[model samples]
Target: MSFETALKTAQDDIQATLTDLLVAFDGPVGDAMRYATGGGKRLRGFLVLETSALLDVPRERALRAAAAIEAVHAYSLIHDDLPCMDDDNLRRGQPTVHRKWNEATAVLAGDALQSAAFEWLAAPLTHPDASVRAELVLTLARDAGATGMVWGQALDMAAESAEDPLTLEQITELQRLKTGRLLEWPCRAGAILGQADPVHLLRYAADIGLAFQIADDLLDVEGEAATVGKAVGKDADAGKATFVSLMGADAARDRAHALVKSAQDVLLPFGTRAATLAAVARYVVTRDK
Candidate 1:
């Protein structure tokens, strides 16, 4: 199958599992959860499933992590669109959770989804070995908690009012935590499940994660709102520094290309089995959304 076909298949697979997780709960919170997760590229979840495939893990087991990561991703987007945060009214070309329901419902839905991610990770179905499940749980806490995504968000908020704009290194570090950490988890999670060394995937994740953000920054600068989803130029509107702002547009694009190369190179350990992942790394730099 082609890469696009494989990606679509993975997206469909994870969404079905995600729907099952949500439909069991009924209410506005459930509605909000479903709404928040309905669209987008399902890129994070795809990373999990594809990595698991390369590692020779069964899709049945990998599907659990893929669903869980997407739940966490949905929760993050809901919160990120909250009034106190980015205050976005639109997400994926539709009303954001807070706009569709209310702030309270959005908050509750995000909380529920975040909690559900851990619940999914802890489930025996994700892995028969208690130790592997525990590792996923522990690493997820570190990546999504105060030290990771939250840390990046906090830094971003702080920079808005600061006298000096963030330096390139600072912004990169912030994005690595805010965006890179979550990206890191799924790639590494596959190896953790396979009982194989996760070190190489970590390298791949690190490169692709940064490239992903840089590509996003490029989109913000060059993409139309209709195509990009959400509003374009949000970072620039907020007067926040970005890779494009710091490194210049041409240079930022170059950096993302370079990172894609690094990402593909790291997967050499997996040889031909990793071709799809290498394709994904390239797609990360090219996707308009």
Candidate 2:
């Protein structure tokens, strides 16, 4: 199958699984949860499933992991859109959770999704081996918590107030922590499931993750809100230092392409098995939203 076809399939399956898992969460909070997760590229979830598939892991177990990552992603988006954070009013071309319902509902929905991620990871259905499940839970907690994505967020908030703008090196580290870790987790999780080394996929994730962020920066600079599905030019309006702001659009685009090449190169050992992932690296930089 083509990469686009595979991606669509993965997106559909992950969405279905995620929706089914959240069926028990009823009422406004549940509605917000479902609404928050309704649409996206689903790239992170795709990484989990694709990497796991490359290693020959069972689709049933990998689907749970894929949904788990997406749930965590949705939770992060919900919280990130809150008034105290990015204060985004739009997401996925719709009113953000807090706007659609209310702050309280958004908070509860995000909280529920975050906890539910761990719940799904801990279940035996994710992996029969308790150790595998344990690793999945522990890794996700570490990645999404204080030392990883949260740390990145803290750095971002700090950068907003600091007298000096973040240097390129600093911004790279910030994005690595805030964004790279979660992207890396899927590859690591896939490796754990297959009992294989994740060094190559880890490298691949690192490169692609940065490229993905650069793409997002480009979208903010060049894309319309209607096209990008959220606020555009917020970084510039906020005087935030971004890849585009620091490097200029042309240089940033070049860098993203370079990163995509590196990402694809690192997956060479996996050969044909990594084709879809290579396509994903290209898609990361080229996507409109």
Candidate 3:
């Protein structure tokens, strides 16, 4: 199948899995969880599924991992939109969880989603081997916790108040933790599922992750709020230094392109089997939203 088709398929499957998994919970939190996970490109989940496929892992097992990552991603978005955070009112062109319900409800919903992600990873359905499940759980926790995504978030919050704007290197480190780790987790999880070496996949994920962030920076500067489905220009308005702000739009775009090339080049060993994955690297930099 084509890469676009595969990506869309992955998105559909992951969304269904998330919906089914959360169907049993009946409450405001449950509804908010559903709402928060309702729409997105599902890029991280797609990475899990695609990388798993490259390793010949079982589809059911891969699907569980994909859903787990999506849950974690959705939880991050919900919390990131909180008033104490990015204070975003819109997400995916819809009211953010905190705005739709309330801050307390949004917090509870995000908390539940995060917990559910670990629960899914720990479940036998995710992998028959307990060791594999354990590794997935441990790595995900580390990557999503204070040492990873949270670290990035903390840095971001601090950056907002600092008298000086962050340097390019500092911002790169922050983005790697805040965004790259989650993106890397899916590829790493895919390798774990198939018991394959993850060196190349991990490397590919790192490049893709950075490129994704740079693309996001570009979008923030050039994309329409309606098309992007979120607030735009907020980064600049807030006096935040982004890839674009630090490197200029053309330089940032070129850097993203170079990262995409590096990402795709690393997949050469997989040959045609990795075409879709390679396509994703290019898509990250080229996508309008």
TM-scores of the candidates are: 0.98, 0.99, 0.99
lDDT of 1: 0.91
* Best-performing candidate as measured by lDDT: 3
lDDT tens readout by residue for model 2, 1-289? 8988999999999989988899989999989888888889899999999899999999989999998899999999999999999999999899999999999999999999999999999998999899999999999999999999999999999999999999999999999999998999998889989888988889999999999999999999999899899999999999999999999999999999999999999989889988999999999999998
Question: Tens digits of per-residue lDDT for model 1 on 180-199?
Answer: 99999998889888888888
Error of 1 at 235 (Å): 1.6
- The model with the greater lDDT, 2 or 3, is 3
Q: For residues 100-122, what per-residue lDDT tens digits would candidate 3 score against the true structure?
A: 99999999999999999999999
Relative to the unseen true structure, what is the Cα RMSD of model 2? 0.7
Error of model 3, residue 91, in angstroms: 0.4
The lDDT for every candidate, in the order shown, is: 0.91, 0.93, 0.93
Q: On lDDT, who's better, 1 or 3? A: 3
